[model samples]
Target: MGWKWGFFTAAMVALSVATWAAGYPWLSERITPPHESTSLAIEAVGAARSAGAGTWAPALLREAESNLRLSLAERRRQEVRVILLRNYADARALLSLTQSQADEATRTARLQRGLAEVEASSSLSSASLAVASAERMSRAIPLDADGRRHLARARSALIEARYHRDNGDPRRAEELSEEALQQAQDAVTRANTLAARYVDEEQIRTWRRWIVETVAASKKTGGAAIVVNKDKHLVTLYLAGRAVRSYRADMGRNKLNDKSRAGDLATPEGRYKIISKKGPNSSRYHRALQLDYPNAADLRRFESARRSGELKNNARPGGLIEIHGEGGRGIDWTDGCVALSNKDMDDLYPRIQLGTPVTIVGGDGSGGVFSRAIQDAVEENRIK
Candidate 1:
């Protein structure tokens, strides 16, 4: 279609042979020189037509049609040549369009192939993430045994998700992926809690269990005392007004609003005892400390909400919130939990006993400015 010239010579030869076969033998024998010239011209015209150059064929058919007209001996040949040339032009145009369509089809095929590859690659990347998450959890044991079992089950589900995808079951694959994402989110969240953390690398932790046993063995006068200063953001040990150790910490994502009801933005204020401690996190956060967030006050508040339709009737009770260490130190950031450095949590863990008193200043009744904000918000809600 694109100006190929090879069809000309073949066209000429074919026409000459047809003329000889049609009884036009020699120029000198039966016809006048002019008549012979005209017959020879007819032969040339046939060849030109066969060559498929027609003026009407866009650029492609234009020349062949013009050439065929020149070979015509009679004026009527103009009409015949025009008709033949138009047909030739139409045929060539069709051929050109067919080629274009073929090329486009090839391109579309390649595009589909590329998208299929992306889908495959995304799947592989997702699998690698699952393996890494599992491996990360395996390196550390959760502070609580029950937490450990849940984490194990989550990892197992992730494996099944991957398996179903590889085996070509998309329905199962989608469901498993959804569950894995949820579990991973929850596991990382819970890991931040101090109620369930582990000893940091090469850090010496408190031998609280040993201390408590020794104290219990000796039958000491007072129970263990835990204190937190919301104003100073300091957690203190009260062995009689003596500061044992202080660690830098981050507050919460929300301001002084103590988390009163479930999903409250405020961190709860007031006196509360540590019920459990969770550990060295397997999460991106360096370490975590779990606090008993939904204490008796929280439950009562939540219960009222449930009855009044202020809370979701089917919501699962979230009881454990925490103080923990994140990827880096400095800056308060959490849903409603305290935060510390990974190294700090490791140092503080052993010193904290199971029933230590935790007094958050901005959190408890004697809280810093933060606690007042929580109190104000709570009061405003009550007024409304």
Candidate 2:
């Protein structure tokens, strides 16, 4: 009986060993490496956050992260532990999807922001250039009704664009800036077209040539000349065919056109000579350099205009146009005279001789005979 019992016990122990060996892999997979799926889910959540998922998919990310943490915690506890493999897998998959969506959204947002900034910058630059061009054109020539209207529109648009830009609406600002640029360009074009009616190409060419010749003559004669550009509101001094100095000047109240007669309030446009100079006590202004108005050319034009009924029969060609001091007022307030500051007059007084040439012309300095002449002479010297 003892032998039989020993054999039976041994058989039972052998069967138990075989059963444990067969189920070891299955038990180990279930019990060891706790929260493996949860860890994978956590890694996925981190990837999503790193990919900017927070910006585009905040709620989804929060839900996935919360579920993963809860699952991991429940897995650590023994009493209320639940099978979380499937749950963790689902959370990980969801997080991956969120990450992809967030990445795409983030990329799109960055691209859009970059494009907006570039467009806004370009539009602002273009608008600024257009406004400057329009302003220069307006100052040089009288703008017609349509030109004025367009210029006003452009200015309004530019102001609005600036407001929008300050308010953080870059897209709207860009649109408005583009509109402003277009309107400003249109105004410039219209103004130039109207100016063409009053100033022919031949006149421009003649002015340019005269300037060059005058500079050459001055250089040869070792003399000085004065040039007043009404539109530029500037006076330039040329000595020996080279520009020596420039000064701000104020013109007549109605200085846009050539003076026709006394009390016309228009500055004359022609060549003349400074015939006399007077000190502060001897003149009404601080100082004065009297010019010879109604020179030979002026008389010829005055007579012709009278015969053609362009000027009144009794109109007398104005005289006594001078460059004087005590100016510095922003606007043109003189009566057909070029006025300068006291300081500028003091500087000019000693440099000017009695016979210094003075030439007054309309429009910006670009087409002025004086500027062109100086430029040409300078260029020639450079070439030499």
Candidate 3:
């Protein structure tokens, strides 16, 4: 009976020892310190904040930070720590993904803003250049009603575009600037076309031939001839077919066109003779040389226009065209007359006599002087 009882006690002690050994690892794991993954996750959260994740991934970062704090507070249990470590690893991976997406989004936005700025600047420059070109051409040529209207529209568009640009609307500004540039370009084209119509190539060639013939005839006769070039703003005195002198001159305010009636602010183009002269005492200018305007050809054209109803029945072809002094004002201010400086007049008045032939031509007698004049005006008016 004693031996049987000892065997049972030994068997019970062995079973108890085996059961204790099996549970020892489980208890040790529960009480152990948290894994390294928890620390790594905390560091990753800090890094994300430093990289601006707070602004770009606020919700994701907030949740991850909250979970990490909860896990750290309960870190005494080994099982709990292990679970927290796993959760932290997942949070870190999510944080990394969030930061990458945020970075990509920020880069894309910056690139778009930069490209918009470049386009806006380029469009503004193009619009400015076009407006400048249109202004210059308008100055050199006589813009008809349609041409004037187009230029006004272009200027209006440019002003509006500038307004948008200054108000911090880059997208609207870019679109408006492009529109302004196109309008300005169209204005220039219309103005140039209008100018071309007044002095076609054939007309220019005819004027050139006439100038040559008139100069040759004057030389043979030992008489002088006067040539007025409106585009060059010059009055040239030709003696015996030789250009003896050239003087800077100004014409009527609207000298781009030929005078067709009284009060027309334009200098007429024609052949004429100096009919008389007036000194400072008798003329408003320092001196004046009257020309025989409305000659036979002028009268015939006037009559024809009247018959065609192109001219008002009462509109008379005005006659007091003259070359006079009081110029050098840098602008055309005459009313159907050519003007020179007082000094230039003093030099020319003594040499020219009554009956001297005078010829007035438009442009350079080549139909190309207006183009050069437009270019010069454009350069002069560009923003300094």
- Per-model C-alpha lDDT, please? 0.48, 0.72, 0.74
lDDT of 1 by residue, 1-384 (tens): 434445676677888888777754442232322333344434543443343322112343333334334333233333355432322333333333433333333344344444544554464455445434533442321324544554565667677867876775444655666566555434433432421212221211232333333334323534445554433465545543345566766665443344555555445554566776665444345555566766776688778878889778885446556666662245445666666767777777777677666655442234333333223323433111
Instruction: Tell how far residue 167 is off in model 1, in angstroms.
Output: 72
**How well is each residue in 172-252 modelled by candidate 3, as lDDT tens digits?**
778887777776666666665655534566877766776787798789988889998887788999988899999999899
Query: Which lDDT value does model 1 have at 48?
Result: 35
Worst 10 residues of 2 by lDDT: 375-384
Off by over 4 Å in 1: 1-224, 281-284, 308-317, 363-384
> How many Å off is the CA of 177 in candidate 3?
1.5
Instruction: Output the TM-score of candidate 3.
Output: 0.72
